[model samples]
Target: MESPGRLPYRRLMIYLDRLGYLLGLEGVALLRAFREDGSDRAFVEARIAEIRRLLDTPALAEAGGVTAEPGAVSMAEVYAAWAPHYDAGGNQMIDSEQPVVRSILDGLPVGVALDAACGTGRHTAYLAELGHQVIGIDRSPDMLAHARARLPGASLLEADLHRLPLPDDAVDTVVCALALVHVPDLARALAEFARVLRPGGHLVISDPHLLSAYLAPRKERTSADGRPALVADHHRPLSDYLAAALPLGFQVRRCAEPRRPALPLVAGTRPPESLPPHGAWDIMYWCPEAANAAMENTPVAVVWHFQLS
Candidate 1:
């Protein structure tokens, strides 16, 4: 039996095998020019060799070395664990999404602003600085604590996005960043945003791009029973966002898909001995060429600027 905190060896092996397959697919599709003679024969040969190496790798065959958390946990627990380092963590999604969301915010006429699911008050602080009467709402108390410390005078509330505590036409702007993916029904949250927004109000939202989530590492957290678990992440296609918003009288003003910059090849060198092949980046080191080809120029996040019609 596998130990409490470790994923089973068979499961880990399956992950490694899939990684190899991903690399092989990328080589055929995107890295064809790099393959020998750029021929179909060369691509098949390369893939076969890589598959052999993966099947024979001794480290991947062994049991109990993998320490990745398994199973899904609630968002509250996930953010509770993430609250302390959320702002400081080098989150690529935040890095890509923030500037675009802020640029939209900068153009809007500032008034009563609501930062729904405002983890750590990152955007709340910006709205306050922009001279708006800002209200930051988040369900996680731990996250709210950080926001309170960051903006002492800001009205910070612990609430869910499906039901905003504000009255009708309460705010002129609503900024929700990197939080909608956790909610199951996009329409409900968008409806609440519309409810509290005045006519002609703006709603700016940012979500981790659907394509990026396929390659990105899943967030891990400890469950109530102390077992390792994955944080819940729901994927909403771009069309779903539009379907949810348009019916609610939201007009699409602007949309930006910020692409991830290409990364240098790291296939020749092994990953650090101290770091095991658990997460996406670590596993990518096992086949860096494929990782680069698969991820290059992919959109990191989708930012939307919508005005209530």
Candidate 2:
């Protein structure tokens, strides 16, 4: 006779939800008993095994491909065509991460700052409110327009991250959020960031870790109009990103994996001026260069931060 209210039951309920199973009250009580009796691990593992079995079932195997429906527009076209919608969506996402943004900006020195790939100027307005002289840039005029409308006083420029229009060693701090994955050439963009940052400047980059995405279960995948979730061009493995940044003279300062809604934030700084340039090398030399080449032709969004040294 096991008690109905237990931790195992709660764990089981969560597992079932994760597996797309609708559990009744009796099922939940049973799980609770298992948890209270110290059998929670065993029961949870069994549930996971069952889900794996379902994933590999013959009926599911017969479905040749898990392709979403067709006739969907490209990500860039979606952004360009629906700039207002895009801005609204971006603002919504940013609002959810306000705490993280605040944490990143906490105690940061106030001065000239660049919000590279400043989509809809969410972070741009955040930086300006802190009294930093901010300059925001984006490839999409529509996005810039929306950003300008939001932050009327802040300077907005239409430019590419891979080749910024700014002069050498101009900004003291650069903050980029959720923008790097869209860039076609991450290495080139990083190099540009480093070139523009002054000595001892700060660079903060926040994006989803590609390794996490790859490891995440397929069931967690998102869909837009029954289409596979669209990500930016340079989305790549975490290892590739680290290698790209390290060689470019960035010394990682902090790495945070937020729990709520689960996101990865990797913050790093440019090496001191005393350090020699990592030297220019072809980004195409890295793994998946062919894939990157194909994406270079496609329009995508990306953001990054670099401090000149």
Candidate 3:
């Protein structure tokens, strides 16, 4: 049972999380205050200052901790070089998928969480901040390099998603963020995650929606040095994903086809016809004729949350 103010604090947190998104960096201090136990005003204020300081400062990563070994092929090589800049770059996935995933995760039990295919620890860091014991795994050493720096206390492993190193029924939650598209056969990965989750453990997955895949040029990406790399992107329709998982004794709790966020228009770029003229305009169309046409028909990403029966 919670105390007098605890229930109110918890309820306030739900509203505040959404508030944080709309407010950005400025909301951090206010949100930080709510994380306190009523008794600790000084501790909360100090932590807020620390967060503000860390947000502005550049990390001084040591040589060994930051280096990513180059891969033999273009598929691997692209991610290897891009690993350092992956978190720093303008990523639509983080902006679009994360908020939806984070909101779903809010209602789930916080315990041991497996960050399957955790690239650069985006979800890993969030799960930790939510008070979960996080174990982050990825095949890319380059991405793992950044993840290691981001989460020093959490266990970060370099491993294939098809064969997770953890024991069966080990984790309480499994979070696979935007990585399922790369695996052609999700059976192996899904089976492995099921094997590792205790009964009733929750699984949260986010991927580029199959509908958008056919409509957009999102699967392939070029590296920093102009080397073209095309990663394998399997189109698993919603029916296919649900079909595969239901047989594993999992029941769907929630699902979302989250729309792409309306980003601030680039300077000198004309606003799209869809965007209403405003004091501060937001637009989704990079190339209004092409991008907007595809975006209008389908969601940016597919997300799911399920609990094992």
Best by lDDT: 1
Distance from true position, residue 41, model 2, in Å? 5.4
Q: Which 10 successive residues of model 3 have the least lDDT summed?
A: 60-69
Off by over 4 Å in 1: 1-48, 63-71, 226-228, 274-277
Give the Cα-based TM-score of candidate 2 against the true structure: 0.59
Q: Can you rank all candidates by lDDT, best first? A: 1, 3, 2
| Candidates' RMSD to native | 6.1, 18.4, 19.2
Span of ten consecutive residues with least summed lDDT in model 2: 275-284
Q: Best-fitting candidate, measured by TM-score?
A: 1
* Candidate 1 lDDT, 76-195, residue by residue in tens: 877787899998967778988889998999999979999999999999999999999999999999999999999987799999998899999999999999999888779999999999
Model 2 ranges with Cα > 4 A deviation: 1-74, 86-98, 215-232, 260-309
Candidate 3 residue spans exceeding 4 A from truth: 1-74, 218-229, 261-287
TM-score of each: 0.83, 0.59, 0.65
Candidate 2: tens digits of C-alpha lDDT, residues 54-170 = 456453334233332212324455557657776545332354344565676766889988899888887889889899999999888888889999988778999988888899989
lDDT of 2: 0.55
